[model samples]
Target chain A: MSIFEIIGAVFLLIGSIFLFLGGLGIFRMPDVYNRLQAGTKATTLGGMSLILGVGFLMVETNWAWMVKAIIIVIFIAFSNPISSHALARAMYKRKRYPIITSKDENMDAYREVNENEKKEEDA
Target chain B: MRKFLVILILAVLGFYLFEAFSGLGLGFPRFEHGVKDYYLDKTVSELHVANTVTSIVVSFRGFDTLGEVTVLFLAVSALGSVLYKRRHDVGSRSILFASSGIVRSGSKLLFPAIILLGVYIFIHGHLTPGGGFQGGAIIATGFLLMLLAYENFRVSHHVLSYVESLAGIIFVVIGLLGFIDGGTFLQNFLPSGILNELFSGGVIGIIYVMVGFKVAAELTGLIYSVLHEKD
Candidate 1:
């Protein structure tokens, strides 16, 4: 293996490690929010890196592998976080809370809008 | 007593599963002689389909696929009937648009790309690992994202019905054409060109494309019914 292939193998190792940590994070995280955060973030990065490594390894034989890998990486980047975000929103709507939250959490603006809408409906 | 009975049941199931799977090797798919060899040999030679699974699904077992598509269509139709009653209730759909701007924008941006990818998968089904079912599901998911994130997002019932009916008719019509052209039902009557090309699998590719559209419409309609039932 040449320099690029060595780098690709290293990336593969890192990707696998991250993927393992992602699974561990899912198992160990305290609440839905924390689990979603850990699961989506780590898995997305891990999967992207792993696919990128495969692309690099196959670059010598066929350049198309890299293109496909990049497309997959982009897809994972776009989809993983969005899906987790949707899941977390659904959980929140269902009244599943995080372990703790400050009184003025960043999402209070959204809550305010929703509360106002409810008030309007009531009126 | 309950726990013991559950464990006993589980043990019996495990034993049966073990007995059933004992003949096959651990991981690798070994399609040896007999029927397996015949399909493998015939698919490449007569049909010129690169993916044997595609040939089997879209040609050899095309009738099974027709049945599967019919079942899906019936399920969607049933859902539409059940949900149709409450559709006019017109209660405010507050469950949607609860997401922030980031999610809404991201989903919107990804929708077209997701659809393009799904179309690509079904079109290339004969040559690739994925096929109509997987691709159609992916397309439905794209619509699902839009449906969940936006209040105004609506796939018209009329359009969905038209597409679904047309696709289903086309699939059956293709199968029927096989009788006229070839001796058997759903036979590869059309000339299968060189293998691995886009159009090499002849009617297999065409049928898969139709199945993709049919499934996409049905699943999208089903999701719409479940999501937008107002009462």
Candidate 2:
């Protein structure tokens, strides 16, 4: 009934929708990299929205509870993406193939530069 | 046969729902009061931090937080040990990348801003709705951004472990202080000064700082375990 409650409900709804989108993206994306990008990004945003909604609701009723709810949202946002990046990097290092496009210039340059640097340091 | 089984299960679930909502009263029993009430009453005035929920987590329910932090620490350790062994066994070099200027440039620009925002969330946690865990995770994002921008970026191993251990030690020390003063771990042993001011909440700010450090250290370690390998 209250404006804050309405806003909270809308955020929760939007968050759920984003979560669903992330799930669909995971299934539908062409490759692991794309799927990670889609799923992780959406889930992070979705979770934040939902937690923020809960925080707002808590604030409306008990102002003291808002901080914790915010914490939950922030934690999710930070950890989810970092974990995703780690997984993505590991896959790349292990030579996992992406769905589309070949010719990875970045990887080649990185290897060359790193290897050269290592050799120099050793010498 | 599988389709039939699925339909049967759905039908049964629908029937159960129908029966319950039809006033048959087959739902689980509801408690009149909950554990939250006790926390709500005590935390509001005593914590002096606006967020009772945060107080419950880092103070009232600090034991659970300790376990969660330990779990993260354990995971990082497990990952590191396995990777260490694997790297020793296989001394192979393989390089791969996506030649996308757009993606690379975008990440370069976006990463620092995201990290700053994460720090903002943690620093203003007591006043606002965010806290340490969230903020630390954000700080980890900054590290992650660097990794994305440049693949060979290795976080200093010694620094990472020191930060992690230091955070763990701080957490324990705070808990021990609480035990010494209040006869309970994480109790508000210090004075709960005036409301709505930093240093007003006894031990709460200290707890948040600890949580932030611990979470940041653990997350950095986690990222390192998964991302970094001997080359």
Worst 10 residues of 2 chain A by lDDT: A106-115
Residue A1's lDDT in candidate 2: 81
CAPRI class assigned to model 1? medium
Model 1 / residue B67 / CA error / Å? 1.4
Error of 2 at A11 (Å): 18
DockQ of each: 0.64, 0.07
Stretches of candidate 1 above 4 Å error? A89-123, B1-10, B13-17, B23-33, B82-97
lDDT tens string, model 2, B1-231? 999999999999999999887875556645558877777777766677778767777777889988988888888888877667643476555343432344355566567677777777766666678888899998897777666557666788788889888878888888898889889887777888777777667777776777787778778878765665545
Q: In candidate 1, what are the lDDT values of residues A25-88, reduced to their tens digit? A: 9999999888888898899889989999999888888989999999888888887888888798
Q: Per-residue error at B84 for model 1, in Å?
A: 4.7
Model 2, C-alpha of B156: deviation from truth (Å):
1.1
Candidate 1 residue pairs that clash: none
Candidate 2 lDDT by residue in tens digits, A7-91: 8889999999999999999999888888998889999999899888887766777976778787667667656766677677667
